[model samples]
Target: MSREESAAQARLREAAAARIRAARPELADAYDLASAEGLLAVRARIAEDTAAPEHLAAVVIGRFDLASWARATCEFALGLDPEQAAAWRRSFTRTVFLAGNPDNLRERFSFAHFADDGSAAWTDPGPAADSAGLRRLLKLFDGPRPLPVRADTVVEIPPRAGRRPDRPPVHRELHIAASGCRVSDALVHLNHLLAEAVLDGLIRPGDTLTIRHAPRLTGLTDRFAALRVDTDPTLPGRLRAAAGLTEEALLVPHHRP
Candidate 1:
């Protein structure tokens, strides 16, 4: 591209970034991170021998949305906490924003995260990409929504009669089976199973499920895991058969006491 053309593209990139900030307001940091010059340096480092960053960045950039992704992580805590949410927004922005940059398209350009525990982080592809990436990431965030079958469904355990409202209930045991399944896919499958049981009337409103052995639903939501997952994979099948349940019941918030 010519200098004039490059300048024009630069201006357009700035304008596009401006539009996104105005539109999302919530994603302001993400926009800034994507447009920041510092990301250029991060992209440069990936031009070394590491291919993991490039492929991983592509996988994430193709499916990440800062707003929704943070919510998915924080929702495990309940709703959005502005401070924690801001931290997450910064995390994803700093990590994947530039990994998806048009200029950072070198074969060596890849991705990495700052987390001590080494979890994956991604970004929504830029607005100039026609929002295809944004739409895809948003879809992942949209669900495990409410099951349509309503039965005054207070599936959660009842609050202690004299307990203080400030005190949250203790977490119930969660059984996590070992599997090669991706966390996101597993969540969808489990949600469907739960929905099936509820629809079949096998699960009733106000019912609290204490599944002794079950497969843990994995995903961003699992970060704020309410269920204590079991490491043993064999037990879940046994428990499912013993209970005559074709699906593993998740002790989600709905089942929280």
Candidate 2:
């Protein structure tokens, strides 16, 4: 990458780091996850799962409604094939929708998954791994024959205010695009972990759980050096445009709903 390109990339990482630190301080401290790396990892993981004919499920719960967050997610889902836009819809949930209650302001999108048991689990709001989650959980199995269920039903996974994350569940990293744009690090890992839990049936529908996305950086060379600070020396926006990242939704917003 050119010096200008490198500088722009650094700026993009800075913006991603800052956003993650400010928004997800807990994960920021633990995982040190960054944006670009996280998004790419998730895209790769989802693509792998979707390519499989078997059903796989996962949940992405965060401070939703931010156009940036939505845009980034939409871009990732559509990353594999633009014309195959419907592929994500079919692989995960069939709809691109949001769910929440007035009491709780969280936007969540869930994909599909199967449990170790014979049951299946989807997204629902009730208790932490409540019957709703369990009901779907039970559906994963084939008493006689297994069938995929893509219900149009909408349910809310009740709010659980205090929760924590299990550290180092799996390896995760961030990869900066040739362009400067970045996503969230912990967020991407969290998505993968969610998939595992869903597959394991540890998280049933209607069951609420806690997740964290700590901001961090990895794979920097021992001789790595900081970028020169001249004329701001960073242009994440321009780089994002250069990279296809410009087409994504507004990720993190200034205010909360």
Best-performing candidate as measured by TM-score: 1
Question: Per-residue lDDT for 199-245 in model 1, tens only?
Answer: 23334333343333233332212222122111224542111111112
lDDT of each: 0.30, 0.29
**How many residue pairs clash per model?**
6, 34
lDDT of 2 by residue, 1-257 (tens): 67866665566565434433432344454443444566344435546753444322233333232222322332233222332322222343222122222122222324232121212223332222332332342222112221122222222222224644332122112111222212332223233323222332333233322211112122231111221111122533232311111111112323967
* lDDT score at residue 227, model 2, on the 0-100 scale: 13
Error of 2 at 138 (Å): 22
Each model's TM-score?
Answer: 0.22, 0.21
